[model samples]
Target chain A: MLEELTIQQKIKYLQDTLYVISGKWKLLILMSMYGGTCRFRELQRSVEGITTRVLSKELKELEVNKLIERKIDNTYPVLITYQLTPYSFSLKPMVDEMITWGAQHRKELSKP
Target chain B: MLEELTIQQKIKYLQDTLYVISGKWKLLILMSMYGGTCRFRELQRSVEGITTRVLSKELKELEVNKLIERKIDNTYPVLITYQLTPYSFSLKPMVDEMITWGAQHRKELSKP
Candidate 1:
């Protein structure tokens, strides 16, 4: 199916998925959430160096895209959890490829 | 190997490969070059809407990262050709996964 598309058509089709996961934080956020539902604070800590503001912003974007779902706990101390939607799980193979390719790239770049 | 890496290490490692390919036009440029060696002018035209300045900039960056190589023909017009490096071929599976996932995402989005 992929081979059928011209370069022009392929680029146009792929841009949507890339837009959903292009940022420095979105993939990292998704990777962190693969462990299942994580509280807002858990995500903040797991994705190191993300500011609370940026984390919230990325979360909102992911939720808007339906890649993730947000659940707010109605408990004594309110809590919120973020989890990857089943739809987002479709990205597993892409993430796996990135991991493999990324490892190779790091090794290649490390050569002096 | 990927499963062994902690999420922290994974993100840190993946960023390098992502850095090389994350822009709006870099992947498009690379996709265009999948046809084999192409001159600067050919690429400029193949990747629709990429201005000459941006094409030059992205081409230089791809060359710098060793994903693509540039060769000067030194012909009457002094042609320059760009080709993907063997190392960059490691990204083929990654690109395939993106094509598949990207197609899926587009289909899902088009649904009412």
Candidate 2:
């Protein structure tokens, strides 16, 4: 499929994808939610090293992109949670490839 | 495979990959080389938008990462060309996934 496209087209496709998932934190945030729905604090803890402010910002960006959905509950104490939208599942293959490549890269770099 | 790892481990793997390919230009530079070997000037033209200094820097980084090799022909005018290494082929699967997802993403966003 990629071979069919001109190099310019190929680069444009890649640019589109990167524009959505470019930052260091977006993929990490989405990866954490893969387990299940998560509260804001839970996500902050799960992602590790993300400050509350930064996590809040990344979550909003993901929401804007439609990759994740935010749900609010009107209980005595209102509850908020986030989960992956079906649309986001489209990213699974790419994310899997990244994880596999990343792990392999680590091993390659560690070789003496 | 991803399920077997803890979330932290997964994020770590991702971080490792992002650390290397984080910026916009690395993948673009690699993609340009897919056609065949190219000289510095040729690559500058192929990648578009990248300045000479930036392209030179990116090529050096790619060389250091072993994704590309620089061949210098010691002739009247030193013919320098760049080509992908076998190890770089490891990235094909991931790059393909990105292109597929990216193109799909553009279609997804254009929906009215």
Candidate 3:
């Protein structure tokens, strides 16, 4: 059985999770991959307005964190795609809740 | 009826939520006050190791976001206590899940 973490340890852990997913385009990247995997251009189009550099950087971070996996197909030019790992999929509900909460609060926050 | 927010709007909204809830000790503050409203000193004790300045700043931010509210007791010396707002209570599940996730990931990260 895992030992219980002290509150201080817990806070640091949360901070680290935030570190993995905290970039501007990280969550957007996750949301875009929700339906399934997609190629580089497809992901760029899915997010809309994200520069290629930023998107590339975010993808690298996600891959390093093991939240996403990249596969390459050796064809004429070669094709690469990205998808969420099972661990990343486990975060789906949390992300969805954040989306729902965002929708609910947006209107309330817009006024004044 | 509320219209669906554009993706950009949604991202901004989540960032806003993070802004409201972010800070070093905010979660700990919320967790400490979890059982009931706590007097200033009690809150300070609950979180442990937080400086008075940081506690004051975090409490003020929580009050501004309506996540927590303050009540004063009429006595020889005025006493102020803080409690979570109903809206804040709604975030309990999210926070608890975050705590659980943090625990699960902490072990994995410490391995390296």
Worst 10 residues of 1 chain B by lDDT: B8-17
- Model 3, B1-112: lDDT tens digits are 1136665665666666566656557777887786887888898887778989889999998887778999988976888888988878766555655656666666655666
Instruction: Report lDDT (Cα) of residue A36, candidate 2.
Output: 87
lDDT agreement of model 1 with the native = 0.84
**Higher-ranked by TM-score: 2 or 3:** 2
Query: lDDT per residue, candidate 3, A5-90, as tens digits?
Result: 66566566656656666655787788778779899999999887898998898999888877889999999799899998887876
Off by over 4 Å in 1: none
Clashing residue pairs in candidate 3 (N, C-alpha, C atoms within 3 angstroms): none
Ranking by lDDT: 2, 1, 3
* Model 1 Cα lDDT, one tens digit per residue, B1-112: 7769887677776776678888788888888888899988898888888899999999999988888999988799788788989877888888888888888777787778
DockQ of each: 0.66, 0.73, 0.26
Give residue B94's error in model 3 in angstroms: 0.4
Give the Å error, residue B25, model 3. 5.7
- For all predicted structures, in order, the TM-scores are 0.89, 0.89, 0.67
What order do candidates take by TM-score, descending? 2, 1, 3
CAPRI band for model 3: acceptable
Q: Candidate 3, which segments miss by more than 4 Å at Cα?
A: A1-6, A104-112, B1-19, B22-29, B32-61, B70-83, B108-112
Candidate 2 Cα deviation (angstroms), residue A106: 2.0
Lowest summed lDDT over 10 consecutive residues: which window, candidate 2 chain A? A1-10
